[model samples]
Target: MPLWNVYHPVGAYTAQQKQEFAADVTAFYAHRGLPKFYVVTIFHEIPESSFLIGGTPSGTAVRIMIDHIAHHAPDPAARQQIDDSLTRLLAPHTRDRGLYCEFHIDETPRDLWMINGLRPPASGSEAEHLWVRENQPVPY
Candidate 1:
């Protein structure tokens, strides 16, 4: 079972938005036999104070978290495409709410996940763990 705890800052989240987002994730995970347990949290903080990069205050645009049993996915491009798709699906609902919120994704590995009494896909590659926080700086 891959569990993800998602945090949307105070101004960025609404109860309805959170529920819709969770539904999207659940459907995605259902396709692969991996259960994506969605947990949404709301917090209030300045970006500079809430996020840090290398112990320095980070000017992050968003924050998210994921926890699971641990697994892997190898295909980077495909994984990215999937993520992009998700962002697109969830973005409009948020952006329209007068929020400059960015979409953040987090995931955990699944080794022996028991979903509906079925084991999940063992693992894949590094790509499985790859997710882009859109507000991040370029990795030049």
Candidate 2:
């Protein structure tokens, strides 16, 4: 599971733009063989007075925190690839729009994660494939 938390200044994105951005984020994970339901993107609107950069309020800065539970980079090369992919994924919504963005990914132990009180099946396993097809947690 890749849970993305996006924080941006209030009024930075319209409802339609938020939906599109979330869709893009979700597709990125789905393309990697994760169940679509495993991807979640949350948009947080920060009040101008509350967002800060260099100790001063900034309206153009965006922050992203990503939690990766089901998959993780096993080596430096793989980690770099993930970072590059995320950079490309965020370009349109941040760089192209003149927004300053910073993001970091944290890999959580998969054993500690659960959905609907059930631990997920192994990656690429038949049971996991069923969850992908169903797009929800299912008894294995």
Candidate 3:
């Protein structure tokens, strides 16, 4: 599974935008072969004064931290692709506002990550499908 945490300065995005943002992130993974249910997105709005860039308080900052199993992106090229995609998806919210947007990915070895008291299966594998079907008892 992949989890995305979007941390943005308060007032930078409207409620609708936040919803759209999450949807876009989810879609990104789905397009990359991940099942929709396996993607989780969380939004955190922080006070503008609480964030800094170059040691100066920032009013327009959006940071997305994504965690996933190792080899998900696989290589630098793939990682850049993801970064570029995120930059494009976030441009509307950051570019015009002179905001800073960053997408950081953290990959952990699958053997070391566990969910529902069990280790997850390989990405997009049949076992993963079974895992999703078994553990995802409720629809998102």
Best by TM-score: 2
List the global CA lDDT of all models.
0.48, 0.95, 0.74
lDDT of 3 at 13: 77
Compared with the true structure, what per-residue lDDT tens digits does model 2 show for residues 1-140?
Answer: 99999999999999999999999999999998899999999999999789988899998999999999999899999999999999999999998999999999999999999999999999889998999999999999
| Candidate 2 global TM-score | 0.98
TM-score (all chains, Cα) for each model: 0.48, 0.98, 0.80
Over the stretch 12-86, how does candidate 3's per-residue lDDT look in tens digits?
A: 778897778778877877676665767788888888778877888887888888898623777889889877887
> Which residue pairs overlap in candidate 2's backbone?
none
Model 3, which residues run further than 4 Å from truth?
96-98, 130-140
Error of 3 at 76 (Å): 2.0
**Steric collisions counted per model:** 8, 0, 0
Q: Which ten residues in a row have the lowest lDDT in candidate 1?
A: 131-140
> What TM-score does structure 3 among the candidates reach?
0.80
Report how far residue 10 has shifted in candidate 1, in Å.
2.0
Ranking by TM-score: 2, 3, 1
Best by lDDT: 2
